[model samples]
Target chain A: MKLGRLNHVGVATPSIERSVAIYRDRLGAEVVREPFDLPAQGVRVCFVDTPNSQIELIEPLGADSPILKFLERNPEGGQHHLCFEVSDIAQARDFFESGAVRILGPTRIGAHGTPIFFLHPKDMGGVLTEIMESPKQAH
Target chain B: MKLGRLNHVGVATPSIERSVAIYRDRLGAEVVREPFDLPAQGVRVCFVDTPNSQIELIEPLGADSPILKFLERNPEGGQHHLCFEVSDIAQARDFFESGAVRILGPTRIGAHGTPIFFLHPKDMGGVLTEIMESPKQAH
Candidate 1:
């Protein structure tokens, strides 16, 4: 699969507000998008834009949310996944399948409004990986 | 702290040889630096360059290595940390200190031969973060 760039590092957080402080007050970050809920994904997400990439802060929207389990494992929350861009989501998916690697599901419109799919953590050396369309602005 | 770029994502592995195939064969990575042991860090390390950043693969060097514990928790290996480049390591260290955040120690030479320091995971949203001097090739 042709990997494009490191788009963002997904950080699972118990509270996006607190996470914002770390990036803003601590790191002196200037640009942080407002937190928005993705009901379909069962999480509240926001983007902390940096020079090279983004820090994606994600908080569980409900008790049964997938992020809740991650939180349980790490109450302090942590780096949940690494997302890389790809020019072709379909080709990326096919490449994973051909290599006997598991893709979580069909590509769906992710928080960035871009085609995205997740690769199983087991297949990625225990690191959850996200493959997404590169440079998508929903234009 | 002036974050320069996402330099690399550190991945702890059981064996660099097995990890090489995942990057070279599966991900089509073209450039992978030779694996070398960092005795002081108690780990073997290598770099796999990507478009935006590189992947630093690290394996425990001996029984007493700190990574052995990480490997114990994650037998298949896992993402260890995220390293971001900083224009000035001293300024970054001061920034963290001014915020009452913990720094593992004073800056020391890292795998890249650049002055680097680690931020305690407890203070970094559960992600062990490395702040390093940007683009230092040690000429």
Candidate 2:
């Protein structure tokens, strides 16, 4: 359960293009990946690279999108979750379970193509948290 | 406004001590600052250090705390804002103003003892954002 870097902050956005504009045009961000769909995850995602971390702009893609409920609660969208890297996802999951922390679901391949699992907000200081294993290859 | 490092993600909490324990005992974070009150800001704060950025845990210190409304809505507390460093505070403020990105208030000294200002969530993709000058002396 050793904590590593703050990988990225997941931001739920109603429009990825508009969010990209804010990061690129308004914030003067130099690198922003084009929005791409992850059908399995039910979202379109764009990465806005900062000097040390990234802003993950996520827009719902389909009717059964996981973030649909969040968007319903916050029509304009907002910060969704915080993702942190761990050396090993298995150990992290085990630690959380042992400590009675609720894991939202099974570990799955995340947008980064690394194993990741979500922790319930109720167990994470009311903030949804994602624990991910550091990717072997640079992404 | 040129984006620098993702300085920190502010987390509003009901109890800084409980939040500190979650980061330390549960998340296995190695370094966490002792909670301290910032009377000027009307919140007690603590920092949970990650490798690249820190998590600022904030708790209301008095009746007139600015985050009182947010806490009322989310009684369990949650992520509050995202802070990014900028090289020049004056230029950053000007850029936001010229772009019609509402700045919440006059630039004031932040927890890091550097000039900082909050951006309206309406203009920031529904996420409250803090623009801060890179501190001359690291905190």
Candidate 3:
């Protein structure tokens, strides 16, 4: 149940293009990948690569997207969640459940194509947290 | 203006002790440093070290703390800001200014005893961002 590196900081945005522009033009981020759609996850995702970690910019793909509610609360969008890596997803789930930390749902494949689960904000000090299985690229 | 590593993610909390326990016990974080008070910055800070980056848990130290309003808005505390390392603080400040981005204040020595400046959330897509001079230990 040990936590690994922080994979990325999830940011919800109304427009991925606008967010990308700021990260690149304003912040001088050099490696911003093209935005792509993840229909299964209902998000259009773009990854801004920093030297050690990434900033994940996500926009709702459809009306039923999970992050739509978050955008509603923060109209201009903002930091949405923090994703931390764990070596084993099942073991992490067990640890969280045993500790009475509420899991949002069953573990499912996340945007990065790894098994992932979310912890409720109420159980995570009011910050939505995502536990992701360590990605191969990270190693 | 090369962007350095993601220095740390700043988390605002009502209680640093409570936040430390959750990171240590629930998340199995191995290195939860002792909480310390920064009277000048008006924050009680504790750092939760992840393998690649750190989580800065900050609690309001005084009534006049800058984060008090954020706490009032998000009573349970939440993800406060994302801090990234820069090779030169003054150069970074000029770059941000040249792009028409709003700098929160004059670059000043931060809690880490390094020059740092904050960006206006409104200018950065509703997310507060901190630019910190790369720390020596990171190298």
Best by lDDT: 2
List the candidate 1 regions with Cα displacement exceeding 4 Å. A136-139, B136-139
**Order by lDDT, highest first:** 2, 3, 1
What's model 2's lDDT at A51? 88
Ten contiguous residues with the weakest lDDT in model 1 chain A: A130-139
Give the share of true interchain contacts found in each model: 0.62, 0.86, 0.84
Candidate DockQ values, in order, are 0.66, 0.86, 0.84
Give the TM-score of chain A, superposed on the true chain A, for all candidates in the order listed.
0.94, 0.95, 0.94
**Model 1: which docking level applies?**
medium
Go through the candidates in order and give each one's C-alpha lDDT: 0.84, 0.90, 0.89
Task: Look at candidate 3 and tell me the lDDT of residue B83.
Answer: 92
DockQ leaderboard ranking = 2, 3, 1
In candidate 2 chain B, where is summed lDDT lowest over 10 consecutive residues? B33-42
Best by TM-score: 2
RMSD of each: 2.2, 1.2, 1.3
lDDT (tens digit, per residue) of candidate 2 on B3-35:
899999999998888888888887889999877
For candidate 1, write residues B43-103 as lDDT tens digits: 9999988776788999999778889999989998888998888888888888888776899
Candidate 1 Cα lDDT to native:
0.84
